[model samples]
Target: MSHYKKRLALLLLLLIGFVLVSCGQPATPQTVEKVVTQVVEKVVTQVVEKEVTQVVEKEVTTIVEVQVEPTAGPFLERARTDGLRVGFVQEKPFGYVDDQGNCTGIDIEVTREAAKRLGINEIICVHLAWEGLIPGLLASRIDVIPVGMAIRPERCEVVQFTDPYQAQGIAALVLKENPKNIHGFQDFVDNPNLKLGASIGASELTIAREQFHIPEDRAIGYSEQVQVIDDIVAGRIDAGMYTAPFVNRYIQEQGPDSALERATPFDSPSYFNTGHGFRKDDPEFVQLWNNTLLEMKRDGTIAKIAGEFGYTDADLLGEDAKVENCCSGDNWQNRACLPK
Candidate 1:
């Protein structure tokens, strides 16, 4: 009985030990799987964090770059700057180079002063032919034309003109000893044998042809008004026609020995107004010039300049001189009443 009992107890104890070992093995496998799953989840979380950091860094960099970029506006990019360049034809009393090789004239003085007020230190003066002034402006070879250019309907189609700087009236010049007693356009046209001299590409020529009804052949075009005056003095032409200020300046500068005398203005009501020319799209430059001109007129700067050039009789502007059919003989007396 003792032997049987001992054997059974040993068998039961072995069986219990085996069950316990099996249960322990299954628990070890479950722990290993849980540990592996936790490790994989931790690695995935780290990768996701790295990707999110990279995306945030890129967004921050983009914001910084945008903040560093420059802003565009008028105050920062004013038109009157060192980059601005101006052009003009060498017309006396209006714009021309002085004997010192420096630019000095009414137009030059006005523009220089305006540029100074506008905080522009860089100014380039380019000399251009009178006829090519508009073309050079259109081609961007120059920024502005401050020459004594008149505002005409035909020219307005191409370029922008500032407010009137100086108003003018037309006049005819002839030799003092000449036999012709010219009063107006009728006198010019009535005499078919009379030859008229005018500057090429000048508004005066058009005015003479249209108002006086003179044939194109009888009207000779020269490059300059001085040439017309010279031709008239030399008896190469019967008469020379141009603005009153130019005629007065020529007479005063050359004196009586120049053999030229101004007759009464040809047409009544024919008034010409001179203004600065600019590119069509250059509104900033145009505004600057117009404001300067208005200031000059208000301060008597133009009158002072005209007085220096012996243009005392020359009106700075014509208020009522504009008359239709100014070329007719009936308006001859009316023309003289205009600003001379």
Candidate 2:
């Protein structure tokens, strides 16, 4: 009995000891293997998510940069951002405010086309007296002087000009009755008793006083062509002289029954080349206009505009016309009359 009992107790005690050691020790592979697998899966998932997020961010950034690069126009975008400010005189045949309050005529038409090609959305014309154009340009109040300004050297020294676009002869206006017998500019020169009428700041007065040797007292300057023509009609002055188209425009506008008539034998400082004027600082602007004008002339746009004002192609300058010395400078010499 003792031997059997001792063997069984010893076996039971050994088994109990083994169970207690297993409970106190770390987990076996069955539970621990699943936890390690879960941790590895989480790490891989985080790495893949981060890589995808970086690639998506880069793609989004590239797309934004590619969508923003255009709409700036040619040559000094800021200068014409608000559009051009053209200045014109209210002189017939070149520029004038019509009864409808619209600006019309040769110079205005030419300028409007150039402004359109330059990408300007607006053309604002400031009406100034003939004498005020140069000052208005220098003061920056005006961008262009498209008032059919003659390209005199004295004018060249102060402001800038586009290449000559017009060349013209001068004509005189007299009463239809021909009481004064003023057929041409020379008639005024020959008759000391006669007083000649010219617009203030016009090339006509300069030519009369300087080129023709007419005394200043015998020649008078009026502010507008109407003033000179009015005097001629009223007989306050013997004759009024200006560019041929100018006198013709007044006569035509006044109807067939008007007392004014074009005096015979047109005279001149001879072959005055006229151009639109601008500030000297505007070389780019002037060049732009020059190129555009040449293009217009070549394309027949210039001829079309001139024709509207009763100007023939002869009234327009050729594509290569340059300012010659015929009546070029402040001395106002008719180089044709000078010693060659």
Candidate maximizing lDDT:
2
lDDT tens digits, residue span 237-302, model 2: 888877778766876777779898777655554655677787666477678778888898889898
Candidate 1 residue-wise lDDT, 13-70, digit = tens: 4444455467774435455445444544565567678999999999999988755422
Model 2 lDDT at residue 205:
93
For model 1, what is the error of residue 95's alpha carbon versus the real structure, in angstroms, after optimal superposition?
2.7
lDDT of each: 0.65, 0.72
* Cα lDDT, model 1, residue 313: 40
**For every model shown, what is its TM-score relative to the native structure?**
0.52, 0.55
Query: Which lDDT value does model 2 have at 189?
Result: 74
Query: What does the lDDT read for residue 62 in candidate 1?
Result: 90
Local error of candidate 2 at 150, Å? 2.0
